[model samples]
Target: MIPTTDDPIGDNPALIVIDPQQTTSESEEAMSSGAASIPGGRDAVMENINTVVEHARSADIPIIWGKELHRPDFADYGAEIESCEPEHGIVGTRAEQFDPILSIDEDDMEPAEYVIVKRRYNFFHRTDIEHILRTYDIDTVILVGFMTNICVHYTAHGAHEHDYAFRVAEQATAAPSQDLHETGLKCMRYLQPRGIQDITDITARLEEYDGNQLVKRVKESGQITPKTGPV
Candidate 1:
């Protein structure tokens, strides 16, 4: 079921932008097979993503950017599974950089915002992303960015396992094809089921709560008690 306006899950959600980097040859091959590509290509999706970023920045919400980076040696099996290899120069290369159109200036990025580098599709896999969220005491995660079916979808699924209240910005994420994009969204909706609202609704919900105040509420309400689990 879609979460309501009164649902505390959507309050003070962190924006997770995934794999907004320049496309590689391997990535293009994956796209041609109807598996992964930024829906409507880079130009169209980046525009919408920029708008999401601007809104999040204006609201002072935490924005976590995720990218896939491989080491010089193919020591990381996760990269191989995702078809991101150093031989192909898919990761740890200039092509792995965020698209320039997004205006992601390092200087302008807030200190609270995190840039997580992962070797796999799931941002939480073998990464410190979940720990960072736990440290900040964030519950909700608003997912955005490229190749909707792959990185973005995997990250959202991982969030579900971690019990994070999550939503995906429909317009802000794209796949190589319409079928894959819709399929990914449907899968995410099935998994979490609760916080599947659009970006517009999400932004409106976030506007109701000031930054960090929602965390305070969750703490006071005892929704997040002393737990030893990853959450």
Candidate 2:
């Protein structure tokens, strides 16, 4: 069973939106094509993520967008893993930019607000993500985005290692295959050990927890402030 946190989520939770780039790989193509042919496909997953994004925005929580991008010359080790580097303009290319379906507005694109250009599966690796979270005093992380088995899984692992209170939006993530998706969820359910809430449940939980009120209540009661610093 997933563990729960006594400190209300509103006390400052960060939303990490991971790897929702374009689809270009064969597996992704198969999934997208199959989804198009079926009643629900790629679009269904994107819509769910968008819904979660809206909820996070309404709650005034920070939304951190992480996209995988590599250098053109494979100067980074990521290119060593594959023959051809992930080019800039190719669809699903790490450099292709955020998926438009996410509906992130111009205001949400502020530099301080989002963590972009993540080259690896784990957002904290060689990135300012940890620093940003520390700067914002965010303790809990709600992870949502694409390719559940790969990037999502890696990020959650990193979060757990860093001792951050972590949550995954189950419905908001998509994998190349249903089996992979289910396996990823099972791994997160066991590995994460805390706050593995469904997208709907998390949305409602965020709405119910008022951050300002919680902060005020904690302060007024003369309670010792829980360390809001990095894990």
Candidate 3:
């Protein structure tokens, strides 16, 4: 179990990658159906994500990749289909899996232990993520991945309600539009001041934690900047 500490990251933290799959717009089906699509420019986002992943791995931090997958019959899909393309994330389809561009290497780490499947936007909703967190005694979670305004945003809420301090990799996530992405970051920052952080900052901190034998804890001064709004 991770030791309790005053530091925001605590003693043990996990990296939570949410829905790192190809956007509907990148697939052939989207061309035919004109379904909802994540905006382009995933290449840049994945580069930052891989950097964070590499550092987290170097620090021996537990990494959990969450992918959105639905039942073959789409029975698990709820009101989301009404808002999004119904065919997305269907079982036995490419959308249901992680994007090939991700840096997840099962040969280097146990695949089963590093991936979680979800049917909804919230990673914790009806998933074993809570159990995994409890097992690892994870006090903080670093969230990064697709649709900054949707899955990433909702998972931040899940982390809050589940009693886990969290951070969002600012440049490692994307949305359908720049405005929406910024809005998502603003919302998360409103939830936790200084929570929307750079991936490099997070990796540097993790490296410090690792080099310090993973036992040292930095006590905070209890200083926090009060936020007026979500900006």
Question: In order, how many clashes per candidate?
Answer: 2, 1, 0
User: 43-130 in candidate 2: lDDT tens per residue?
Assistant: 7777877888777766666678877765555566454366332233233353366667777754546323465677677877778888
Best-to-worst order by TM-score is: 3, 1, 2
Once fitted onto the true fold, the runs of candidate 3 whose alpha carbons sit more than 4 angstroms away are: 1-10, 24-40, 84-86, 106-108, 111-113, 211-231
TM-score of decoy 1: 0.76
- Which lDDT tens digits does candidate 1 get at residues 21-47? 766665555543233233455576778
Please give the range of 10 consecutive residues that has the lowest summed lDDT in model 1: 31-40
Candidate 2 accuracy as lDDT: 0.66
| Best-performing candidate as measured by lDDT | 3
lDDT accuracy of residue 133 in candidate 3: 75
Q: On a 0 to 100 scale, what is the lDDT of residue 48 in model 1?
A: 72
Better structure of 2 and 3 per TM-score: 3
Give me the overall lDDT of model 3: 0.70
lDDT value, residue 154 of candidate 1? 89
What is the Cα-based lDDT of residue 195 in candidate 2? 50
Alpha carbon deviation, residue 213, candidate 3 (Å): 9.3
Judging by lDDT, tell me the better candidate of 1 and 2: 1
RMSD of 2: 6.8
